[model samples]
Target: MGTKWITFDLDETIMQNPFGKWVFPEIVNMLKKETDTEEDILDLIVSEHLQRMSEERFLEAYDWDDIITGVAGNLGAGSVIDIERMVIKHSESPKIYLLEDNMLDYLKRIKEKGFHLAAATNGYSKYQLPVLQKLGLDRVFDEVITSDSAGFAKPNPAVLKKLSDDGEITAHVGDRIDHDVLLANKLGVFSVFIHRALPAEVLAYPIDERATHPSFIKICEEKWHKENRLREMPFLENECIPKVVVQSVEELAEKIGFILK
Candidate 1:
């Protein structure tokens, strides 16, 4: 057999979007001019966006302009907002942090174990490249494959197949079952689901517990519920299922070590 390889999903698997807290509030402010209540506007926009993302068909279609326009139309706002400006502003500020404290060290150890590492993510290189740099992981991966560069996205096996030309992909690890796990399964590779709990900071949106907005609290609760529901749902025979599930980088390292063995 050729050298073994292991692929990882970038967002939410190894990285956390610390800047996501600003997105909802900024969007709420932008829509406030067209709407009366900021709370209702926030709730409606978040709910609509999440609903779209939950659908499998819309997985690769993350067009914020379309999503924002749809939300505005639902509110009878007539698409007055400049969505292109908003998307550009947020897309450029792609800040990310490691999901775990020891993630960098763990990745280094994995590299030391002689397995080829690849970042098989569904994002533009313009955005993901800077994130990897910021986290000091730009040089860690043997390959960093992005949707923009690969001409496709996960759960398409071709994205991962690009890395398998000279090696055998032993396993793939990611937080999303729909994308990462599905992609791994398609390639007949072991899938490791990393189920990290939502951070308290993300849940503590609007940043003030004393003046907590009902809409913010509701959104957080609904997000938690949806995450749990996705995890508990039964996978159909046609749907992809992970070979193993892990909750932390420690468990992930152990699992990968076992796979390599």
Candidate 2:
């Protein structure tokens, strides 16, 4: 089969939406209660959380609980419970927004090449669908399938299989190497990894802590969660790496061998 269908990962693959805006400031204020807690220290903690989200090795050494525990350090800080509560609250109900506007033109270009487009994301309808609507992409995407709708998440094989049951030449495009690429590769479908711009918050985050200003965070959350799942499933190998990797969508058409008008 040729490339007749294209599936995308929503959060960072196309859009960069961060949840828990309250998390950073709240943690900073609480940290100051236990110790002098310079903004630099809080920035370090924020950077750690981000690294934990992106890098598997960093996550293995520390998690959200570890970060908080390191902060309080046996002072019996009552704020621990409050902080955990805050994380849980915002994490469950994230503040979703569209960070990239260029995906529309990219999707339109692919669609014009006679390929159907679908969004296969591991997010909730309440949150994910609204972002698409806000970006005016709700109608543009042929179908939107989320974890809530799919009853399975990525790397599950079931999610990709469900999409393939429709019998179309499918190509999966996402930012995460482990999640989108692994899933597509597992299913023997053409996979493309689009290295979208990193969030500004991540790039501008304090010095040395950041690799570079991400030119791009829930996107980060999704990465962390996906990494955790991959870790748990040790048997799963990334046997199928992406066939192509492009920095932007404009470069996607030729890379994927799709011709646009």
Candidate 3:
């Protein structure tokens, strides 16, 4: 291969979603004024959301808009027009943090070593691009490919294959085994799985008896969805296993350097 490249997954791998937890709360507040009791409305919406998540095929067919529409239907709420606008606004300007300290510096060092970097993620450019710009990584990657732009999502090798078009992809790093590792293994690229601890906000969020129950919170935490996908998918025994596993992004940086050397 003439040039070596490394690809990174965006959401949980490079950035933490602090804004995610607030999305439900914002939706609840928007609908609260329509109902006589605010707490009752919140609890009802949470319950409806939990019911949908508990379904067998939820993970495979999950869509936020659909979930919100169901919630509105269940509550007999007037219209989802305002709710849709709110969701789009929140999605466009997500408040996020780097998963590791000095992540930008680490990526810069990797670039200095002459390795092309690409961001292969399963989101729209409108949403993912803003997060990159906020992280000051707007110009970091040689290519920023998303599901909307690529017409393929993770666990489908085509997403990663796009990066391989310009050069050989030496490794792919991400937080999900089902999506990220599976595709990398299929493509014969080194798969590095980075495990991030759940954020304190997620762990410490008060678990109310109804609205913010454990099951409801579980669906809210994206990490839970990742783990659930691993369990649900059939490739865990063979095809989806990662070549290396690290607890933090700092450790991932160290492992990447050692592996490439």
Q: Each candidate's TM vs. the true structure? A: 0.67, 0.57, 0.69
CA lDDT, candidate 1, residue 246: 57
Regions of candidate 1 where Cα sits further than 4 Å from its true position: 1-3, 34-39, 42-55, 69-95, 196-234, 237-240
Candidate 3, superposed: residue stretches over 4 Å from native:
1-3, 35-63, 78-95, 196-226, 229-235
Per-residue CA lDDT of candidate 2, range 104-162, in tens?
87778778877888888776565466557756678778888876567666655677565
User: Mind giving the per-residue lDDT tens digits that candidate 1 earns over 129-209?
Assistant: 756776777778888988768877788787766678878998898877667766787888877767565345533542223
> After aligning candidate 1 to the native by TM-score, how far in Å is the CA of 35 from where it should be?
5.3
- RMSD in Å for model 1: 9.8
Worst ten in a row by lDDT for model 3: 207-216
* TM-score of candidate 3 on Cα atoms, chains taken together: 0.69
Best by TM-score: 3
lDDT per residue (tens digit) for residues 1-261 in model 3? 567888988888887643356566777666666654445655665555445444433332234555566666666667664443443455433446776779888787778777888888775565566567767777788789887677777767876666677679888888776668777889988877665554455335432112133432343244444455434433333455466555566655554566555
Which 10 consecutive positions of candidate 2 have the poorest summed lDDT?
208-217
Every candidate's CA RMSD: 9.8, 10.3, 9.3
The lDDT values for all models are 0.65, 0.60, 0.63
